[model samples]
Target: MNSLIYRALVELIQGLAVLMVIAYVMTRIPSFGDLLNRRLSLTHRVILGLVFGLMSIFGTLSSVDIFGGLANFRDLGPAIAGLLAGPVAGGMAGLIGGAHRYSLGGLTAEPCSVATFLAGLIGGFFYLCKKGRPIRIREVTAVMAGITLLHVLVITPLMLGLSNEIRQILKAVLLPMLLVNCAGVALFFFILQNLHRERLNEAEKHRIDSELRIAREIQMGMLPAPSRTGDPRYAVHAVLKPAKEVGGDLYHFFVRDENRICLAVGDVAGKGISASLHMAITQKLLKALAQSGEEPAGLLERLNRELCDGNETMTFVTLLVAFIDLRSGEAVLGNGGHNPPYWIRRGDVSRLVLEPGLALGIREQAVYTNQRLCLKPGDTLFLYTDGVTEAMNAHKELFGDDRLKTALLRVREKDPEAICRGIMEDLAHFVGQSEPSDDITMLVLRLESKEDAAAGAADGC
Candidate 1:
């Protein structure tokens, strides 16, 4: 009995050493450190602790040859613990369990104790390394082979040399232990792979959500408010609807002085976050150059140069800038690969087409020229992004330019705000039952004579 007690105490010490080694290796792995930093909830940590504690107790029993030496399967529990709490916890459990088992039996020999400790240490190491990650099939096979080799070479000989009874017991238990360990490893890997995939999907969703919020704010800021007054001669009304969280459309109006109103509309090439960011930059630069009293053509030329200077990405913007002289009722329009504006008078419509130039950001030396239009009393001007004309219906039919022109002619006599709303409604009707595929923006301006304004105010109230 005394001899048995001595052997058991020695085995327990060996088990402890095994646990320490496993813990050390687990802590050294980068992924294990990352898991710890994620700060798993207290409940999860407590649950993992309980699991490891139980596995350690089982490991001790296995070492003592209690319950017919099948206690070696206790390693499976620690392997599971390592997979959940990471290698450190798993390894510590294995060591403590192995040490307890050794202490409870008289198997204190160097070979037996060392072999048991190594088994626990190796099992814990693999468990921690595979925590919250998928295990490759090849890696699983390799780990199984390595464990088998360790048992056959070190464990078999040690038990056989110790005594005939010990040899027979170990021989009977070894195959079963190997099968259990292999299954545990396989199960841990399966769980880890699923968890890793879920984590990646969640991370991607969070990133997209964050980007959408920023893009929405930038898009809203780029638009001109309904109450903004650029010049009293013209009442401007603009609205934008993005098909996605953010889009490439942009519009801005600034009163350079009492006499001059600077207005611009632009569409960046593409959609979503990248396009939205480019649109914001383009809007800011256009506003700055317009405020400096630069001619419409000169502003485009400057913008092209600024955009092309150091930009590595092949992004371009179609832009139209106009300077309206309220006193003379004349407007100077400039184009940089943009759609022409529509001029509406008494239900008759004409497009103000300018000489098209390269889109902004393509080349620094690209030039833009201006076209002049004289605004007639009660005449309206319409500017829009391509989304309006290119919208597709449920039947896959495009709401073409002809349809847009007809809609504008029908609503020419309406108020600026009403005209914009009318056009949007018409487009929606045309594209029945189909979701918008791009950013839609419309800006309508009607030049009212000072005499009509005074008469209109007097007629009202």
Candidate 2:
């Protein structure tokens, strides 16, 4: 009797391994989710029922010897169907398995058949209780335990006619069979629940992706046109690549008054929706404040105070702003903890001198000072954020100032668009397969006459 029970436990384990694989595959089917979550068409519902019934039929065929009679996890198919889906699929699974058991024709056959058929109803009662929600581990365990008891204690004795000899056989077989079937059913349910969770996680991932796309759109739209033209004194072009979480990097060139156009480049301290909002506010405030005819230093002084006034978050930004007179080459610029621009005079690249002040909003008392420059026709000022110098490679190497200066040499005698794109391409090649750590932004503003513009255009400038 001990040897037979041991063999029976091994066989039941082998059968349940196959059933768990089948249950995993079944739950992954798109139609199966519709059966659980939405109203299925009659044709789909029947097809699903037939598949569950087939699972029950397979269970009956894999029966093992327990004492003198055969035992199998045949009822688990319909019971799981009722617990996961609803009554119809459960009842169908029960009918199919029970009919197969009855055809085998033993003294215990009628009782086992009745119990198998009722297992589906028992599971269906819980399905109605949960109302299609995923069943909890404790609840599923309790339900399986109750179904096992009904088969062993209530239905079998009534059918076989209670006797001391028959009761002794049942007492011997009941414990092992109950434990084995409940374990098998629990393993199967575990696989199906994982599939349900994965589906929900995939849905949430798509939702975040959709919202990020929209936020990026709104951020880009806030900038002044990438190529701006007011008078023939200067032309502006810029390029920007935001990090995965959009960062605050901004460049704007707009007519400040009849004789001048103001240009500024700024980078906020952080990334994501918060930084994007800060970038938008900075651009709007600059455009409004520039209209007051403030010079670069006055604008920075006032902008810093405004940003610091209500800022409980203590977020700050690096900025360089310049006001250029269209009729003359004279320009006045100011810096607030920003990188100094590269002054390109007739194809020569050199760093422009600008003393740094504290970054805006870092301290309300921070003062920005004016730097003066005279631009000859064909001279350009290239402005960029530190993302250029600090960009990392796969080997964790920085694309430092020396490499940037070398790349800048190649951009000379080129137009603003070419200058921006060429450096970006070189940066991408150097940083191959490395995730970007910060936002990159570049702007090219050149003092040009009609004759200079035509000559620059001829050389692919």
Candidate 3:
């Protein structure tokens, strides 16, 4: 009897180890995990039910048989199926395992098969009662204990073999089977719950990634492509490198007419999705107002009024709008709580000085002034967001105005695109491997010679 008890316990342990491996492997397979999580069709449920039913048969075959194959922990797989996958799955597994047990044809065969069916019924009952809620370990232990007692009561009275051998086997294996099955159920359910959680988390991540990708595409589409602005006198290029999937920085240029070109760059107070949305709204407003040929200061004033109308978010944008005359090279630059642009000419660099007001969406009825500057042939007007000057290195050092001025002087590009690319390269080298903390946006516009402008105008005609 002692050896029987020891061997039963050892068999139970080995069976549980195999069950753990099976559970782990199933979790790794996407189809199995999806089916268990109820994400698949009824066909998948039926397939899994059949599979787990076979697993119960396998558990029994692998266990130690004693007293003419009277008792074992064969019902573990069926119980788990019913509890985790609900009633239909449980019933299928129980029927399959029970059929196999009857085919073995022992004294305890009928009783064992009956016990398997009862195990499935009980598990399914509990699962139905607690729909959509995680089952606790204590609840599983209680169910297993009840199933074990029911098996003992039914089988002990009905055993057809010599009474003494039946009693000895029952005494040896009953307690061990109960202990093993209860522990196995708890471990198996816990793993199932964890796998469900992991699936949910992965699904959520995929959803967020898809949304960001779409948002990036939309944001890129909103800005005008710098390569072709439909003007020949002004060679213009712009770049916006957002630190995140979307950002608040914006730049736009449009030739309002034959003699006037409108240029604007703005930065919202924040970053990421919210900022990107605000920037889009600002761009639409600017484009709408630019069509009326509003001067730089008037345009800023009208934009501020529109933004502050229902500004519950309290977000603001610092903007710079400039109008350049294609024939005479006259620029009217307006500053609205934004960084002043740099004036580049004859190998010299200086910041454009302008009277400023609060950023848009802050104060209603805010007024602005336009500062005039005359651009000569070969003169370049460079505009940027704060992200350029405030870029930080690993040591917490900022790439300030001085470094930017030096970069501008060193760039050899006569075209706006090459110059913008050169400055971006310089900024990346300065930051090294440190991630940018903000969106970096830059726009360059170089005025061409009057003679060249005339010749280009003739070509367009």
Candidate 4:
């Protein structure tokens, strides 16, 4: 009886080994290749089935001593097959292997084979469920407990009814096998958890990048292009350099009529899509008011009222709007919580000092003040957003208002295009290979009187 049981156990183990090999081969097939593709859904199912099949074979073969008269059924391959195959596969392997053993050899000594097969099946299930995720300490403990109970209730009782020597040998071998499978399962679980986390992080980064691209497109569309102008004496040049895909800075120049030029620059309160949307709305409102023959201060006041009427978020904007009369060379300027602009006359730079009022979108009844400046021949006005002064260097020092004023003095004689380019170049160099911290905007208006230039420098003296 002992020889037959041992032979049967060995045959069962061989059958399980064949099934493990079959699973590995099937995984290589394209249709089933995905199962072997690491942490995939089908991979988990295949691994589980392989483990159960191995366990069943191991238990069955051990019951019928098929090999040459040997009574020892000690083999690591079958248990290892279970460990690698995961829970479902391991359980099925165990069941099939156990049944084969019982059929080959009569139920002699004890029916411990049934219990051993069930333990293998349960272990396989636990491993399958936790294939791609982390395994907690509790999970390890639970698996160990289940394996121990199955062995004690089924295998131990049957072995106890057999000879003392047989029982003692089986006890020594089974304990070591259980320990090996438990350790393997715990290690694999930890590895799977880390992989899952890495995949999630990569996905999140891609989503953020996609959103930024969309925001950049909308922001660009809100600004006026160089080709939009129709006047000859009044030339306008503006540029926007965003530190990110979308930024808070904005500038627009439009000819409201043949004799009047309406221009405005603003900086929104935040960055990205939200700021860009606010900039679009502000530009539209200002253009509408200017086209209706409203004065600079009146336009700003109306814009503030519209912005603050029901807005509870308190998101505000710093703005500067100037209406230039081409025939008279006079400009009416409105200030709304923004930096003072520079007026350049014959290569000399001076600040246009005016009392700045509250920012737009803050108080519903806010008032704005206007200042007037007459543009003589060869005179220019430069308007900008705060991005110019807020640029940061490698040492984290801000290129503040003082530096900006100095840059303007250095480039006052250049044409409007050159002036805009020179200021941007100086800012980039000052930053010294550091990333820009905000959006940079610059608008330069050079008003040249047609009569003065045609009279061979009328004011040359």
Q: Give me the candidate number with maximum lDDT.
A: 3
Better of 1 and 2 by TM-score: 2
Tens digits of per-residue lDDT for model 2, 194-311? 7667878988989988988988887888887789765675777998899775679888888877767788999998988888889988889988888887789989999999999989
TM-score of 4: 0.68
Error of 2 at 290 (Å): 2.0
Every candidate's lDDT: 0.70, 0.81, 0.83, 0.66
Question: Compared with the true structure, what per-residue lDDT tens digits does model 4 show for residues 1-461?
Answer: 45544444445455444544554454446554334335535557555555445544543344323222112221222233344456455555555555555555543323544654665556556666766554574576456545644554446556555465555444444433344334433433343344346556767878888888877876687778843445557567888988788887878788888667887889989877778777778878878877777888999999999888777878899999998877667789998898778898876788889889889999888899888877766788899988898999999999988888789899887778888989988898999999888888899998765674324233322
**In model 4, what is the error at residue 403, expressed in angstroms?**
2.2
Which of the two candidates, 1 or 3, achieves a greater lDDT against the reference?
3
1-461 per-residue lDDT for model 1 (tens digits):
34543454455445544644454455456565456546676555455545565655655454445324432545554545554565455556556555655565554333444554455456557756666564584576456546645754566575546466655555555554565456545655554555556567878999988979886986797666854564566788888888888988888887888767877888899998889889888988888877767788999999899888778997999998888776666788999998888898777888877898889999889988988887755777888888889999988888988998888878888878998899899988888888897888888787776775435433431
Location of the lowest summed lDDT over 10 successive residues in candidate 4:
66-75
Task: Write one digit per residue (lDDT tens) for candidate 3, span 267-355.
Answer: 99899999999999999999999887778999999999999999998999999999988776778888889999999988888988788
Clashing pairs in 3: none
What lDDT does candidate 4 reach at residue 231? 52
Off by over 4 Å in 3: 1-22, 35-73, 83-145, 157-183, 393-397, 431-434, 452-461
Better of 2 and 4 by TM-score: 2
User: Which residue runs does candidate 4 get wrong by more than 4 Å?
Assistant: 1-145, 148-191, 226-230, 452-461
lDDT of 4 at 396: 94
